[model samples]
Target chain A: MQQRTILSTIEGHAAADPARVFCRFQTGAGTEAIGYADLLRRAEGFAGAFAAAGIGRQDTVIVILQHRPELLYGFFGAMRLGAVPAFMPFPSPKQDHALFWSSHRKLLALTGIRFILTYRAIAAGIDEHFTGLDVRVLYVEDILEGLAAGTVPPAPPAPAIAPEDVAFLQHSSGTTGLKKGVMLSHAAVLRQIDRYAGVLGFGPGDVVVSWLPLYHDMGLISCLMMTAVTGAELVCMDAFEWVRRPTMLLDAIEQHRGTFAYLPNFAFLHIARAARPGQRWDLGSLRALVNCSEPCKPQSFDAFLAAFGDCGIGRGTLQVCYAMAENVFAVSQTTPGQPVASLDLDVEALESEARIVPAAPGRDSRQVLSCGRPLPGAEVRILDGAGGDAAPDLAGQIAIRTDCLFTGYNHLPELTAEKLVDGWYRTGDLGFLHAGELYVLGRQDDLMIVYGRNYYAHNIEEVVTACDGIAPGRVVAFAVESRQMGTREAVVLLEPDGTREAAELRRAVKARVFDVLGLTLQHVEVVPRNSLVKSTAGKISRDQNRRRYMEERAGNG
Target chain B: MADEESFREVAQAIGETLMVDPATITRATTADDVNGWDSVTHSMLVMEIERRLGIQLPMDKVFDLADVGELVDLVAAARSAG
Candidate 1:
C-alpha cells in the first residue's frame, strides 16, 4: 500500500478495500458518501469526458466549484487525465462581479489556464468574464449528464503521470494585490502527505471532519489529500454553511463520531464566542482538534477552553501548527494528543528588540503559543538581518529548506527567483526559535490574516478608491487589532476634502470594501489628504497609518 | 418608488440598522451613492428590514434590488401578496 504519487496512493486504498468510505458530506435531503472504488470510477468517468473534449496532459484547468461533492470529482477527474488543476474559491453570493472578473482576469492570463471547470450556478456570471481571452469553459453538471447518456465520451486509459510533474497550482495571497501561483509537483505533494502525517501521528483509524474551503492549502492538502493518502475517513462539510453556523462543526463531529478536525485560530475563538447558552456538544469523541492557517492567539485558546469546558472537551486536545502553501502544506505542526505549548516572554524585548526572554513578575509579559519542531528532512532557520542563522532568542525572518518545496511560481520566473534561493524558500513570516520549538511572530510584512484568510492592505485600498466622491488612490487600509473582535479587522482611512460628511464617508468606505472583500470593517476614519504619511516612494505607508491609528485610538480611550 | 407610508417606515428602519441619517435613505439611495451598502452589510440590511417588516426576503430578489427604493417595493409587494 506504500506509494509516492497521490494517484497511486488513493488507487492502493481502493485496490485493498474498494468499499471503504473515504469522503462523506451533507446533501440537501441527507448525508451522501463515496467509497474508494466509487470515487475512482467516478473520477475516471469525469476524466473520460475531459479526454473527449481535448483536456488532458500539458493543460492547466481552472476549477472554481463550491464545497459540494462535485468539487472532489472535478479535482480528481482532472488529475485522472494527468491534467494540472488550479483551484480558485467559488465567487461569494455577495461578491462584486466587476471586481471579481478583473481580479481573476490577471490570474487567468498569467497562468495561461485556458479551461475553466465550474458548475451551472457560477458558470453563468463567470462565463461572461472569460470571453475574449480564448478560453474554454466546461460545466460539471452538463458533463455528468453527457456521461450518463453515453454521448459525450469514451473513457481513455489513465496517462503515465510522472512524479516530478506539476500536480496542482497553489496561489499565495501576498501582502499586496498580487497573488502568486505556487507550482507543486506530485513528488512534493506525496512527500508532504508522508512527512506531515507521520509527525501529526495520523493513522487509518482516525477520521477527519473539515469545512475549510477546498481552494485553500489547509483544506485541500492537510484535510483532504493527507486524509485520503493516510486512508483515514473524512466527513466533509460546506465551508459557507459552516461559517454561517460554526457550531455545526461540533454538531457534525458528535453525529459522525469524528475523532479529528483542523481549523484556524479564528474559528476556535468564533465558535466559543458564538456558542449560545444551554447548547451542548459531546466533544469528548475528538482526539485531536488542530489549529492552523493563522497565528495562534493565547486569548483565543483561553476563550475556547473556557467555553468548551462545559462540553466535555478537555485540555491536551487542542494543537497549533505553522504552515504555508509554498512548502506544499505543513512545515511544522505540534505533536498530536498534546495540549498547546504556552510560553511567557518579556513583551518589551519581543516588541522592541525581537528577542525572547523569560518574563519576570511585575514586568510586562505576553503569552504566545508554540507551533512545534520542523518535520523530518525539513530545515527551519530564523535568518537575521545579515542573512545568517539567528540566535535562539532573536526573532527574524522564518526560512525553510524542505524536500517538498514548490517547483516555482507558474510563469513569473523573476518572482520565483526572488522567493527561492539555494533550495530555500524565504517565508515572509517572522518568528524566533526557542527550546527547539518554533514560536512564530506575526508576518514581517503588512499582510494581515482575518478569519484565517489573507487580505492585503493595498487590495482593500484599491476597492476603497473605487467608491464615488472619495479621492481615488488616496486611500489607506490596514489591519487593526480589536480586543472586542479577538482578531485583526480591516480599517479603511479615506482622505476626503471635507465636502462629504465624515460619518457618511466612513460608512460608504466600509460598505464598499466589504462588498469587494467580504471582510467586516472595524473602523473607517476620514482625514485630510495632507495628514497621510507617504513612503519615500510617494505611496501611503500601511505601517505608518496603522501605527498612527492605534496611537490615536489609545489617546481617545 | 414605494408608497409614501412604506417608504418612510422602511427608510427609518434601514437608517437605524445601518446607523445612518434616517432622512437620507430615500428612493434614490443606491449602493454606489451610499457608503455602508457594501456586500457584508447587504445581507444584514436585508435581514434587519425583514425582521422589522415581519416579511421574509429571498436573497434572489436581492440580486435585482439596486437601491432602497427597490428594497421597499419588494417588501411592499411581499406583504401585500402574502
Candidate 2:
C-alpha cells in the first residue's frame, strides 16, 4: 500500500469506519463523540468555509482552540485544501492581558495570518484584550453550523502540491526567545509517524491518550496524526483539566481501554503525587507509557509504576524517548517492553574529556539513559565545534540527517541556514554515540560555564535533587553574567518544601552542586515549590527563568 | 475578633506554605505581590488554601485572586454562606 498524506488517511478511515468513534472530548457540560464520517464531513465543511473566506493554497491560517475535536477538523481541513495552518497556544491565565495581546499580535504578524479559527470563548477574550488586530475571526460553532446547514460549497479543485510542499507550521517552544515556525511537509510528518509507529509496533488495536497541547509537535503528530494513520482511537483532554484532576486522565484511560500514552517527566511526577489512594481502576490494558519531551528521571518512573502497579502496569512498560520539533517528533524511542537502563559515567571525566567513564561505587556519577539507536532512515552524528563528525564515545553537538527532518524554519532563511548545514540539522544538543546508541546530555545553550569548567544546568539540578527536602527535578540552574568575574556564574533556583530554611537549603544545594561538578555555586534562590517556569509542553523554560531573574533584579535595584 | 483571627491564621498559613516571610503577609498582598509567584506556585497556593481552610475553592477564583484581600474576601464569603 502506498503511503498517503494525513488527510487522506483520515478520509479513508471515515470511509471504512464511518460509525466508529474517532475522537472523544469530555467536559463539565458533557461527553461528545465524533465518528469518522462526522469528522470527515466537518473537515470538508471547514475546507469549504476556508475557501469561501478567501483562504486558498499557501495562505496561513492560525488555529487557537482548546483540546476540542474542532481543532483537528480545522487543522486537517485547512491542510487538505493546501493551506498552511499554524497552531498557537491558547493564552495562559498567568499571562497578563497586555502580554497576551502583544503575544497574539506578534504571532499574527509573524505568520501573516489573517484568518483565525477559534472557540467563541477565546475569540471574546482576545477581542477584549486587543481592539483592532485587523484579522478575520471565525467562531468554531459558526463553522460547524455552516457545515450542518449544508451551506458550504463543493470542494474546489485540489491545488498542485508536491510531497515536499510545506504542509503546516509548528512553532518552537519559544523558551530561548521569539518562537520560530518549523516548516514540516506532509511527507516529513508521515515519515516521522511511520518511524515511531514502526519502532513501537503500534497498530489499529492501540488507543493513544494525550493531554499535551496541540500547539506542541509531540501532541499534534504523536497523539492526533499518528493515531489517525494507525486507525487508533484518540482520547485527549485539555492541559488545565489534566492538571486540575489528573486522576480523571487515568480514569479515561481505564474506561477507554487506552493502550498507549506519553507524558513529560514533570507530568509523570504530578500524576504520581496527585493520584489518591483507594481510587482503583484497571489499567491492565495499558501496553506502553512513553515518557519524553523532557529528561525522564528514574525517580519519576519509579513513582508512576509504583502508584499504578496494582492496576497492572509493569516495569518494562515504562519507555523513555527523545524528540524535538526540528526532527518532527521523535528521534529515538526505547524499544517497547524493554527494561529501562542508564549509563552511569564519572561526572568529572565526562565533562573534562567528553567521554563516558564507568563510575566507581560510592562516587558521584552522571547517569544518562541511552535514547536507543536512531530510527531507520535517520542518521545520527555527533559533530565537533567545526561541524566535523566526532569519533565514537566522544561527546559533541548532536546532528541528524533524516527523511523525517522538517523543511526549515518558516521565513527565517538565515537561522535555517545556520541550523541546516549540508542537509544535517544541528540539534544544538550535546551528546555522544556509544555503541551505536545516542545519549543526550543537555542543550548547548543551557550549558553553564563557570571558572573554565563546563557544567550542564540539568546535571546541577540532578545533584541538588538528591537532597531530601528539595523538590526533585524542580530545580532551575542557569548561568548569570557575573560582573566581578567577567564570566558567567552558576545560579541555582530551587523550590524547597516549607520546612527547609533558606540558608539550609542554599547550603545544601551549593554543597551538592560543588561536590558533584567541582564548582562553587554562585547563588541559590529557594522559592516556593513549583515556582519554576515551564513551556506549554512542561519542559523547564530556562530563558524565561533568566528573564524573570533579570526583571526581579531590576525591580529590586 | 473571630474573623480577624481566622483571617490572620489564613494569611500566616499562606505565608508559611509559600515560604514567604510572615511579615510580608498582608490583606492586600497577592501572588503577584510576592517575588516568585508563577502558575505552578499559584497551583500550590490553591492546594494549600484548600488544605488549610478545609474549603474547596473554585478553580476560577483560585486563578482570579489577584491579592490577599480578594482571597480573604472569597474565603469569608464561602465561610459565611456555609
Could you report the DockQ of all the candidates, in the order they appear? 0.10, 0.12
Best by TM-score: 1
> Model 1 compared with the native: what TM-score?
0.86
Best by lDDT: 1
Each prediction's Cα lDDT score?
A: 0.78, 0.74
Compared with the true structure, what per-residue lDDT tens digits does model 2 show for residues A178-260? 56889988889888888789988997778888887788777778887788877778888887777676677788888899998
Candidate 1 interface RMSD to the true structure: 5.9
Q: Residue A391 of candidate 1: its Cα lDDT?
A: 81
For each candidate, what TM-score against the reference?
Answer: 0.86, 0.78
Score residue A463 of candidate 1 by CA lDDT.
72
Scored by TM against the true chain B, the candidates give 0.83, 0.79
Judging by DockQ against the true structure, name the best candidate: 2
Clashing pairs in 2: B29-B68
- CA deviation > 4 Å runs, candidate 2: A1-3, A93-111, A119-136, A148-150, A175-177, A446-557, B1-23, B48-55, B72-82
